[model samples]
Target: MTVRISAPSGPFRDAGIEALREGLTRRGLLGCGAGAAGAVLLGAAGDARSQDAVQPHALAEFFQGHQVAGAALSPSGERVAVLLNIGEGGARRMAVDLIEAADPSGPRRRVPVGDFDVETLAWANEQRVMMRLVIPVTAGGNTPTGRGIANRTYELQSRRVVSMDLETGETALMFGDERVRMRESLNLGHIVDYLPDDPDHVLMAAREFSGLMALHRVNVNTGRADLVERGSQLTLDWSTINGVPVMRRDISTRGSVINIFVRPDGEGRWRRAWRQPTAQVALADFIWIGAAERAGHALVAARIEDEDVLAVRELNLDTLEYGPPMASRAGLDVSASLVDARGRYMAAAFYAPRLEYDFVDSDLGAHHRAMNGFFGNECNVVLANADAAHNRFIIRASGPRDAGSWYLYDKAARHFEYLGARTLLDTRRLAPAEAVQVATRDGASIEAYVTAPPGGAPGPVIALVHGGPESRDVLGWDRQAQVLAAQGWWVVQPQFRGSGGYGLAFASQGWKRWGDRMQEDVEDALAQIIRDRGLDAARVGIMGTSYGGYAALMGAVRRPDLYKAAISICGLGDLGDALAYERRDDESADGFVYDYWTSRIGDPRTDGDAIAAASPRLRAAEIACPVLLVHGVDDPIVQVHQSRGMNDALQAAGKPVEYVEVPGAGHADWEDDVEKDLMERYVALFSRAFA
Candidate 1:
């Protein structure tokens, strides 16, 4: 279901920066050239020595694609299906490895799907697992084929969901009704619920030609759907409690308010229990997770005015009131609620800038903590999936020095068996990260992570601003951070304001204050780290993607004294021009997209003064450092124009700027072979800049 980003991050951008807006299905399957699935890469007993034995010079190859694209736990939790990438470069072939939870090292099942980029892997039932992927529908959007309908050519991405029998390896396409193809919905394969209770069917949501959001109970085997409910324009995500349709979240047509409603029973009247404006100030962060055991009771994650940190709480459906905190981590805010198959809250997950979970079930929590101890506590231990009886779990453990590996953990037997590595990189070479807090203007404090060269010697530094100005930096095995660190530069990712997961008050201060307060927070963190780490100030360079890219260019424009070099990958140049693009010929202005961008960033139509003061392209004359711009030619999110305009502005101002136009690339090219080459280019440029 499409959840309105309480705080939209990349691909979740509220119509703000198209570049930040991710497609409904971004499974890393760029248009074409996916080879046949005839070749198998990894299996139950596959050797990972090749992945682990990556040569020092070939370390960048690890950044090409994910070794473990995704992992799904079977309904019975007896088996964990892992999607492993085969071969090299962007469009790597994929194979599914079904490892036994009892003994992962033993013989298991391997199913290969050649050239298909499987974005998410989920269990349709105990005997079935389904994969969601994007298909290149070249030729035309509405072309008729004997098999089915052909969506828009490469101009727009089409999606397909495949259901496979774990035992037989036979696969079927989901949403397979030819009867509904002519209806012309935007996203055809939108899955809502897996329906563990009803293994034959799952809930799906699709926007019809009438612009109404409808829920369908589709048989995974037959692909026939029966319409369950059709909602209004304001009403968006449709959700189910257990196997019953009982909840729906809506954003006002104006996009200023968010309303959450729950049904006492599937047939009962809708009750409004939560309402909050999109504004960051004076906000009450509440998200409906699942229905509680009681008829009118529900579980939710809330960060109210009294406490900025999120905690799991009980919401009374009848009285529309929240009960006491059911589960919370002291001093740390909860990022998500971990629920069981029956939709009961079992734990609260937070990022101490890393993966940390607090289980409500004391025994489970203790066992999880024990697993962490078994991993030496340096690695992040997560119970990715568990059996119906909670007797076994799929454990994922990773750290800065570890690429991460899956484990089969037997709770009853207290046994842990290694499954496989999560990536192809030899992560043991990554530098350890240190957390630091720096005070900025207005008595505000910011948290950041600094990874210096392993030798502890002071050297050049690079301030990597994270994307989603709404998105905050997370701690763990960071690929981008490690890539630059490998080049002997100190990298500090500041958890700047307006970034999510830091409570609303802190994040609210960042709303619509970009290029000023938010920019100051980033600069303050870098200044403090430079002083403390003794990094050479003259050699410092700033870099980032999307919003981070915007920030990178703006940093050089506003404070050239701090940066000697800058690089912006697919970054936006003009904030005002970007928002203006979102508002042009688009859907109603009242929609979330238009409101989200205008709300987060000032509207160019009305906030011209504010936008002009912040736009890097408009003030290119002020940028004094050598800058670099890189963009994907086929990027649908943020079009190539943004980077092109930025490069034009810099060159017009007689500034030193190098522009790299990546052919056949989109918003994210991590899976593409060029990613490695581009990464190497970055290291070289910084090497020369800091020389």
Candidate 2:
């Protein structure tokens, strides 16, 4: 059963930023704490309130309401650990609350986890929880060496993992040791499995001295680790089943190759199961949905030869073959699978317009359908966590307008009790995002999302390109788009050719076409939106972060007449400089970053002319409109130098440009104050350009 809510009426009421802040305070959205007070104080100090006194909503409100942070369910299903951002401004900090599952509104206890920011959390057992920490690192002239797993060239200062004993209120670092000299190192092994049978130990993938990742059996309580499986020299990634490492991947210039190894009877010599390329591996790929009761067989999500979408199937490990489909969707990819405590595939989820689930287990499906009916599907529902018995679980529902809420589902009583919302916001005021398709000049259909102001009438549009030209935009409550809409600007997010989530054919088209076809797709979206919605052609502007930022600058250089103004946040300027930096930082001569970039973005060493032509810094003189450059001083991914170089080049050309350098901000870490300031600057700059 699926329920859909009506699209919001006209844009939200044009209340001033002050009124928005006051409303948040009156509604207790901003807690009564020093951190909250600091945030308010910081906002008061800003000129945002003075710049646009009659503007509806404060930028701070949007930022505050959008952050629910993280949540996890206990193995016993008795308690839920929720991580929320409390306090405001620089004083704001992340706090974890242990709430009772039965009585969510009842008094809860705060877990003292210390100063570091918690990135993610999971249950080690009913009495223990594991947490990954995001520690701040100072920016200097330090160049990271070697490509880390996943072709990551820029390394964070520190990423540590630790375990907390809820019973004793004690926590210990999981990776700190005398043997390992953790200097500028990406420490804290990645958790593979909790090993439910052995609560004291968890399977982790830790980086060894050989620059290869090896599997280890880590003791959560003692921080002692024993090597379980050693990685080969070419091992790029690995997967395990029932706590046993069975598959390893080697990524090469050609493509990914998988090696499947099996151990019979849980002991003796490990023998080869099978080997295949990514295309063949996709045929019978094993998904780590759960620990199967049957040793050599597990639930898998795979794509058949003729199918465009993935299907849920039972995979035979011994023979590397797939059985009949358990659940298959026509056009949508199978997103995830739900397994019961007994290791049985109970449900499968797929996303068509929004997320929809099918029950493979009749009993569990019926119960979930009933729960959905009771909950009322105004928002998409997700099963966050469940206990072994499948009798109790945590359900999170969220939509494009709604921030989201958590609920506890009791299977025995067939009851769903309200927990708490991540934030309290007036949904009526938020604009609804509509999925759209635009035909490019080359006749390729590009998937895009457009969020218009209250009325259907078009106005000044902001071409908000998404970062990760590799990542695609989906339907959700986008805070940035909402904030822009509240200020009366239409936001168009285009999923250019190279973006993921559509299909291999669609994504593969983006490779090595960064500035050429990729930029064309973005421009085509803007032109199509103008024609379709009758938007003001002269008032269109382009802005983005990272790759999106790169696109913004490139658009201004390549098609200055199309965009009225441009903004680039942490964007790359020179392709040559970026590739050179990667080559210098990477210890491996033929590393993944060097090879991947060479294929996807063109090699600076060999394809120097093409790279130079696409570089925004080199073509700065061609930009005719005003440009806003914003970058974090401590950004590791695309260094601060990128923005500085572009700013210098523009200044040398006597072009209209403004630069803002955010202190102590990394690639992904933006302070509340910094974001608020940027929002205000955007409004001021764009308003002037449009006027």
Candidate 3:
């Protein structure tokens, strides 16, 4: 979630920074020896008290509290469009509306896309759009799960392609597919994209049985499709090759490789155009923006890297020559738009780490005030390069306390006004966040945040570890972390090595060391905060979900002295079990998965000793702290037995362990009500144990 970021002004900004240092030093002293004195010392340093305003609420109530969706812009930069829904349907009902960009807050004209479901929507021109609509189908009898409904499927016969006139509010059916190929409990109509140059043609790839992908080109005019290619594993990317539109397949290789395929030159045949190197680079790391206005087949690509800014490169197909990066360092997170025939204006967005609204302007300097909201850093922009100066864009905005909304930014008015329904969130109430930095065991700097209950003395701190050992913690509104702090405990989120959003080198460093220095990163974060006296060293707790959960379990077993309590949610108990069970149908994806774990954790067969040492279940006996284990029974990703078996071991050893099972939930999407219940239980349990 996005957290509204501002350079804390007035006396609060300086005061906050000072308080953090004092709190840290006091906590550090307590960790060394002094206990009560350290707590008091830290308490005396803070100016603002933790607020106790947020009351417990139901998750369903929270879902109903807000509207969420994306806003789209017209190519001419005159009109802004957005998708909105009225009621809460599992499959959201969509309606596109157009509003005047000059008077953004004014009324809008609504255009209904369809009733069944808006599978995909793409702009055909400034006044027209292509949409894929599908009818939902359900099986006759109940499967075995809990709900009485049959498996739902997206039958080809149940889908129709239609074109809508934005200016006239008229719709026309382009094509209809009536083939019923596969029979699964639920059919997913995977609508990937529409041909960039032609609205009558759409590109779609579906996962057939046995994990093979069926790539098809559907003609909107004829409703007929031809299978261009089929592969056991293929990821497609689209772009212009030699001025001709083409499709590129990400095929199996060392890492990820792209093979460009061009349609037969005037002969109605297909041939390979150019292939990217296989070892180090992946075509997905960069997306083609638009070709230069010049005559040659020069294409522009947005190159993705460790840094936030998007790199622009000029690609020549005939000579296969690539130009140096342009538009580099556009204030960290820089998004760009291609200019039109006149080259009058180009739209772009730029952002930095300090916390502020994303700037979306033709000159890249406008729209700061409109973008700045609570957790504004969470806002993302999608630009439509429809002939350059005339462009359409979508902004998805959300934060910890607020659901996200989409806005349409039209260059004509120099404003991005609000569009329709937005994604609902549960961030009505939240706690203040304290940004701080700590040192790793090796003295390398680590960034972290410490947040506590409002109006409360510096209390117990929970080492809120993040998953993705490859993911980094950015400044934003975090519901889970804020909720813990509201419960009177200090929340600490550490960005350890292998965390992205930092740089490529740092993220890749965690490649093969999951529990070693990676664990040290978490430990150092906790130790530094304790040394600073921001939290009670004697009553510290460590908790994480997914990868974070794994870290919590490992932390408890490896160093119980620093953490008195541990919470693990959907954590992996056995590394070997994960590698074996985590295989997808694609062997290449699976191989990379296996390589990542085994190289970092240990190979069960080759490095049996290391795997056993790293697996939490095998080391459960070493954990002396109280542990809370939560798992979802229906989790398709992480097996539930990972938690059950570990809990049993702890129980057998006479250790304090509580196991909570979510009956019909998955790994991350636990039913909304279940999330609230879990939060309440965690808060009460931590308060009782720590306080």
Candidate 4:
């Protein structure tokens, strides 16, 4: 029940406040309510820096110093707004920073929003930015309970969306009365974009009020919304093509059919223009650059692949004719994007066995030796980061052992210029990490990233599985991954069967095969890692949140010989129960949502026996390791009872199990110190367990 949370250092706090205030001012915000904002920032900074600053350990270095998150680039690429983390005393607080794109090395100044932490930051204009803040809630508030959907006097910390001007330090409340989507809950998922047709209008793309995902139009200046599109029979995947909005909706519960529709001029009525025949195993990629310079029409670059071959094609929106499939490679890979409006620019990331991007410009390539940071002489100039333009111009560069550094190029200048580097932890200060690809006993290829302790002499290792078993890991700046490495645990993140980023076949490999191939992927990954690298097989443990949490329990029970300790945070133990609690019978809520789950996992009714066999609760007796379970009492995604019931069953079975439940908390949060508490507790527990 009691958890010890870690805070940032004293120096971090002083710098945070100074940085936050300067950031706010530079972004054109006058000031937050001095009393409330100051108190919250001070409190958060104290929490983050409670422990005295000592030797710069990797974990300490990762979260201790000046850090930035939630970064958005202005449309003109002239300004950048970033979220800054600063510590006061021992607590950590969130503040905003605005930097001129020309001189992004340091912010002109910081804004001091003492009471609010910026969750999602966007550059509305070069002079104005949009920021959404977390509203705090008071505890021990009286409630008036009632039957007819009682209007409970909820103690909500009112959050308001504001547009702040950088030049004059002017702040205007934008969407004050509009209800925000819940923080962590998959709230009728929506994508908000500034309307191209009307400067004051914004498009709110999301599921309808009935809960099926769709697109809606909202007047940004006036708090008004009109339903523009209905939810798809399947899921609507939103994308922007050439400054135009295009939605790809998978029409089958099993993810079979896909329809692509485009909204003319980014705000005009959306109509079906083209359709990609949805095959069971085809992975597709689409990117739209701005209107073509010569043609003055939308240009969409797309690529589709099946288990056998990968094909790339260009679609001319005006003519509606498909370009000949250029590079028909054999592999589940291809990502394309336009560099800019010019028809000559193109950038594509292709993965067959390895990962790299192909940058091309027809005229530039034919005449130039080095075109826009890309050395035409050699393909070995591995593409690290690309700008959002159609050509995919290189914006940053790094290698296997190097941390990425940003670079800017002015085409008129025809030369690459150096920009200040954005780094989380100093890679040179940290030990080297190895990449491992293991094949499951079932003959499936599984990929993972492994970082050993600094001294090379192997000690304990932690298997860090990812949530969204549907999502996969790519080489990038992952904070948690770096934190685990700093903890001296060889952090192992396995791309299990159901994980995306892989081809469709590999991703769908987990459909209806949960706890089978999925579980086996973790086991196989660890086994190969132990064999190839000298990991202390006996000292290995497991930890994850959500779906990852479920795997921790399943691994402990299924292979007691491999894991000695396990930690599960908000993981589901019973799929049947989880589905029942989260899903509503209302078709408006989502007709295909339940069907999608049933397809990925067996139906609890017809496949009751399989469901039971795959569930962790059914195999609790096989668990041999000590376990730690953490849950939020009000988690909407995976009900809190999943962990509660498992704990009770473990105690009844005479197993060593401990549970820590936080009140007034949901699934998980990145905006509050409560989240840091949850993570720090798990680390302490794992360290103790290993000891």
Candidate 5:
């Protein structure tokens, strides 16, 4: 059997993602594409897309196998480290594979990772590989959750750092064998800084059973972590110089208020540098993106007193003063910087929905630009990693047609070898997405993607809202959106104000808006699409996952006249229950996640009226259209009860509803068969609704 798998481009990049991304781009997507997936997949069928006709598996192909999300090159550039889809049918999972960079088809070592999924990869050296992995945890009866033995309890995702030896393929959890509570604060991985200069050690923050995240210098090979500095209860992450912790960023336990502190050296007294609020939904502190060109000067992210957006500044590490602006995006916040093997800043990067870099290193910058141009500049091209000599390189690219693919570049040879595509493609049905800027009711314009079948004209429309409330949809190859487009419906993904990456004024206002302005934002975007495309507004429907799912349900209740149908997947039905659930399962009362939610969303204890007003389950009868609610039975984040209760409420109200609880599925991801089932149900629901 031949199996094809691909990568994930996301609305929610997860914890420390910006750091991981910038680090990997400097070192290693689907690692950021076009040759062939030379990697092997176990127990898979023939090419479903190769059939003359559009097979039933065209959409199902998305769920069939896992794909490589990203990859990196070894320090010596001798081998490539990337996770690939490897397992039997339906149960397929991601595992690490070390293949010779110069000879991928030659000798290789496969590291079986069991059920855990590899999120990102780096190298301790040429022989040892390090990774950030998320291991699924199912909490139940008689557990620390304090739930009844009869109650099924589970945590959303349990993330940890793991290291593997290429010689023996032995893997160990880098944090040690301590059994800590599931609800560790984001600081556990909040600031994972991979040291480019130090080959054997990676600096990160980890939490104990209680207290603030302490800085640890972890040995990449021995799985030994040495405590470097213990932080305060509010300490989020620390900045370092020559392996010594010198600065730190601390956030208020209950709100978005953040404090920045720094010292003259590792042992100096800490003093306040500044205070800032998370005014942006996707706020990133790139204060020290990379090492500066000159000694004693480091590249830092700073916002001038009068400026609204952050820019790149050469920070004087000694006096702690900002130098002149090195790069600014005018209105957008700078999120990351590109540094090469020599520890030189190549470019400054920000999410323009697509990654746009302000190149400082002209030679490498031109090479990157040329790569993008070669792919028509319509796709995202990233320089994944490079050798110390800066000769061999890894390149990744993804587009509307291509899910994602990797290429090996022999810079000295001026050659690129296609490694493989990230996702399994149904070439016969792949669709293109056009980025559209639509205006909200408040007269503010937001970006959205309008996806359609090949040469497809606007007709029946489906609004695809992204989750994360703070998570923003990007202009990338999205499988679900593409599948919906293959169904012959114009799928429009709205980057609502609550969504991030736009700017301050755009996302800040939507923080507490929930079913109010947030719902209105989706409504406004859909209305604009209908008007601009001259499509039948009556046939429009709304759907999403997590927070996106909540918006869909609210769409049915708020504007039944506009949306004829709705689909909510693992969505929150009651805001109050969600808050209570998090609080109950919380390992630390000071966790910013619980506090972040309450700060943006009012505390359910005190804001019952507002909570009830926005809850879809609380107002089930208000919905006039047929609704579909799909949730993972083992989902620990939003909990399956949220959907079940909504189902019961709709049934009691005599409203049409369909509900499904997928067994063994969790909030973060689903198994292959489960994903296939989901696609089928989604298509069936839309078919009946629009017919």
Candidate 6:
């Protein structure tokens, strides 16, 4: 995929870059030569005239354009590193810029790197920033040969890690050896912790030849590493506190259980802290949040048997018992926790109708209130980072209608300065997503978000189910939902029964349910939305990606009258086929796949009847609504053959179906032109079906 980087046209075309450069130059921190930096800047700019020639301020502009993916504050809070997207469509690349915290206005030094795109950025110290680069790979060249373990067979682009000095613009690859690169390609070997006391090194977990992960103390300046601890064969995850690996999780297939082991002093044999049967794991176990301030104690999130939502609680490592509840919401799960640089628990955040943060630390609480009061309640203000003294903070403020902006707040000066928006967009034209509860046919209350057009009037409804059936629609800015709303469509994102962030009961209900209870939740939400908004049921359609795509196809087959059209993007059509493919490619132990499928999805051997019944390809004849199938030819998750199989089945069954295969696209990855084409096709298909 080739992304084009051309200068964008508009009044504010060079405003952001120029302002950043000027601010840094004025502060006497400009590192790169102006002439060389200018060339890079010019190359990063898009041809705004060309964009305008094709379409002026088209809805696609919102989808196109550069964006600030992430930012990090220096230890001294004197500077911030922002990761910015510099190109459009396939040619898009991520660039890191260092901006002065005092005056984040003009041109800043942009870190020079190779052709690889910046995936993530973090401040290693006051003067150094760590970067993760994503190296794109071709599908054909990276395809697995099916001879190795499933886990090892799957191909992935290499994620190279590097660190750079802000003052001198010097860079060094943290881990770029063949072994490190190979492990990274398989999603292993990552910087787990940055030892704050030792700025020269970071803790990383990398898989060895034994296929077991081991902790390594890696030098940041040189690609040197030292073994810290060898992980158990069954170790699935590990946690660290104060640069010490204190806890680790081991999965055992004996009874399909997960064992949590703890090493109080980070030495000697690991003692079992807790264990849960795999069948009861998702619903009954505690999710390790972080190591607590107090030794031999840790923070965890779990839902008590009597509780309807998950709550953050303190856990004693020695006794494996719960302490006191730190944070909880009546109908929502405590999604995340905030910890300070000193490892002190500060606050807990939950998402109900919207994201709400409850500060546990008094100082952080006061800061939260002050920032919210200053930014207004509409914005969800998050304290991203703070200085050692805790007087200066980097605050990220965003809402359903807002596209996120950064701010620097100084407690001593009682001053707050606006940094910049992640992306410049007209919020007035965007729609706000409202959380609503819908009752399922089985008497279950599922949470969902409704994004309607500017006016509150009812219009065409699109059931946009999120992927992962394991993932839920959070209260935030959803690009696709907003784009659809701009096209006069009410986008309904349902937090189906099996969706995550809703406690174990809700998510576990989705296992083995697939086309049954899972798809029912989508239909139930759409029905309730139509009734609540008085929307025309005949104008409603179903659409989703990944598992959501599967749900969309199943919806058309199960409830043809409810949806006039169905669009599946990179969706699974055959459960048995998908399971088989996973079994062949997964690198887990012999019985791991079987056990996981049995517990999460369903045993293909024992549940073959149910799997066949739910397979969209097998039930193509029952699909009465017009169907549009979109797939990425290089999709690593759900193979492109699934879409091909569904199309063939639909044609053989004499049903109306349209299939679009995107080349050089993996899973949900697509360029601007591909996205625009898909959007146009959606508009045409829905318009035709609704008409």
Model 4, position 211: C-alpha lDDT score? 51
86: Cα error in model 3, Å: 2.9
Query: What TM-score does structure 5 among the candidates reach?
Result: 0.72
Per TM-score, the best of the predicted structures is 1
Assess the local accuracy of residue 136 in candidate 5 as a C-alpha lDDT between 0 and 100: 64
On residues 600-650, what C-alpha lDDT tens digit does candidate 6 reach at each position? 678877889999999999999999988999999988667899999999999
Please give me the total number of clashing residue pairs in predicted model 5. 16
Choose 3 or 5, whichever is better by lDDT. 5
Please provide TM-scores, in order, for all candidate models, with all chains considered together.
0.77, 0.71, 0.68, 0.66, 0.72, 0.75
Number of the candidate with higher TM-score, 2 or 6: 6
In order, what is each prediction's RMSD in angstroms?
11.2, 9.5, 10.1, 11.2, 9.1, 9.4
| Model 2 root-mean-square deviation | 9.5
Q: Candidate 1 local accuracy as lDDT?
A: 0.70
* lDDT head-to-head 1 vs 6, winner: 6
Clash counts per candidate, in order, are 12, 9, 44, 51, 16, 29
The CA lDDT of each predicted structure is: 0.70, 0.68, 0.56, 0.55, 0.69, 0.71
Write one digit per residue (lDDT tens) for candidate 3, span 191-243. Answer: 44555455566555655455566666665555456665564455444444332
lDDT tens digits by residue: candidate 5, 1-691: 1111222233322322332333222221222222322221111122323332543226756655546666778877778887777666656566777788766556667777667666777777777777777676655555444564455576556687777887788776676644453344332463356676787778878776667678888777766777888888888888765566767878765434567777755776777766544423345544566566676666778776655567888776678788878788765777766666544566787767676778765566656655554444456766767677776777777766567777666655554555556666633346656688887777788788887654455578998998877667767778788778777788888888776555556667786689788888788777887888787787998999988999999889898788888999999898888877666654444664567677767777787788888889999999998999999887755789999999999999999999988877777378656777778888888888899
